[model samples]
Target: MGGSGDLDAQLRAAMFAHLARVSAAHPDGVPSDVINSFRFADAPMRLIVQPGIRKPAQLDAALTIRTTWTPPGAAAPYADEVGPDGSLRYKWRGTDPNHPDNRALREAMRRQAPLAYFYPVARGVYQAIYPVYLVDEDQSAHEFGVDLGQYPNDEDDSAETPLDRRYTRRLTLQRLHQVLFRPKVLRAYESRCALCRLRHAPLLDAAHILPDHHPHGEPVVPNGLAMCKIHHAAYDADIIGIRPDRVVEVRQDILTEIDGPMLRHGLQEMHGAKMFLPRSGRDHPDPERLEERYVQFRAA
Candidate 1:
């Protein structure tokens, strides 16, 4: 605890130093937590620094770059783009190894262990991205995709074919969606299950109203519901339905069947109950989206 606390202090100090320099150059003072976009050649990058270690060999001096964004109202060209190894593709034109600016930036990253900060992509929206660090200003395509080393491929496809690559890509993208989507849904629902009102974090999942592969489905919070693992599974299987009006409806067969406490208490009893929604109207599940998914549940 003591060591971590000290590390936190050192990180904050380094973050402030970066902010101070940025603020001096900008007419509008930059917030300590926000990296000024104009200050960086690409985008404001935050580095995670660890300064408490006594040995020089133990130091991680590189600033970790995690996310990138297009200006507001612009399309995200980098959407669904992650390397096979799970590294993010952040476009930065300043990677030419000979550039003095790149050299100075690298030096700064090595000295200040800046901390990871949330990047606001749009109004009332934020996300965390895969981590990366600057290597050199080589202007090579490899610089955009840093080798974070090979992670154990979760999808075991024995044959390294295009089909396998596609499967890996799909799995990797879904994993990224969960990272950014779950937290947003959990917060919107205040950590309570939308249907069952379950409050246990370990037992909860950020359930997607529409399967991710659906053309209209997005990683946005409005398309998600905080549901207990069981309810989420039931939802995905079309055993339970959420009406556009936020009513919970169980499949007719399940409701009429004689079952154990798990079915009766866990699901059947919730039929006709109102789903808990986000406090903000804008954050509520889109009625059209609900209707779209509900049609499937009703058919099942």
Candidate 2:
């Protein structure tokens, strides 16, 4: 049996609608039953769509999903597998590569081979866009929470910037970490080790001014140093410490009997060298915090 001119368009629409409904209802995403039932793919290709989610939301219905098999031809034929009857069960198979069972479907998909990786539906959560919204939503300034300004919702008051949202999110997540020291510890150091300027953020750490087991009070930026692992242990154990004026100091105890170039070239020469400074005014490490950290540093 055959229909003319619009069978393909009609099938695509039905499939899309099914996916949307599944996404809207489940919140978690479409169930495999729903996905498989649609038979949505070129016989040789598998195709499915899912909504982008950051924080899981409680949804009351199963998500809608659409699947289709294409037939081989000059115009790849598209078959709509999902019906609006709400039967969330079904099965399908693409024609075998050599068997010709799926040949019609494979040819159809070849004609429509290049499909966009993902599409945006203004009303639905999209992947890249969802993360930005998760940020603005958590930030107090934008309690109402919205998208990244690409689309307008009936309720949104204004636009959004992706960079601003990302910054706010990163700042908040940092504040919530167990780093204990004033977040200024990180900000002061510009995410670089003060000694080597290892600028990668994740690789840099805010070393405690006082040892963790020490009955120390809360963390302060001055009480911390942005140090890479090697430098941090050395500084903590009194192998090294920087003077207020920026000169590095090696302990008199460590000057005993070391013949290695690393000891001579790295430490002795490094003495009196300036510590790296933060780029911005606010990032200046607190001298008071430094004094506190020095207590344990000097003892070793």
lDDT of 2: 0.43
* Residue 99, model 2, lDDT: 27
After superposition, which runs of candidate 1 have C-alpha atoms over 4 Å from their true positions?
1-178
- Prediction RMSDs, each to the true structure: 11.0, 20.4
Q: Write the per-residue lDDT of candidate 1 for residues 12-120, one digit (tens) a residue.
A: 4554565445534421112324442322223443342221011212133333333443564678643424655554443342446545333433443344333332333
Tens-place lDDT digits, model 2, residues 2-83: 3521444444444555555654443222334443344433332123333211011111111122222222233422322222
Evaluate residue 297 in candidate 2 and report its C-alpha lDDT on the 0 to 100 scale. 59
lDDT of 2 at 171: 43
Number of the predicted model whose TM-score against the real structure is largest: 1
TM-score of each: 0.55, 0.39
Clashing pairs in 1: 47-114, 49-113, 95-137, 96-137, 97-137, 97-138
Candidate no. 1 TM-score: 0.55
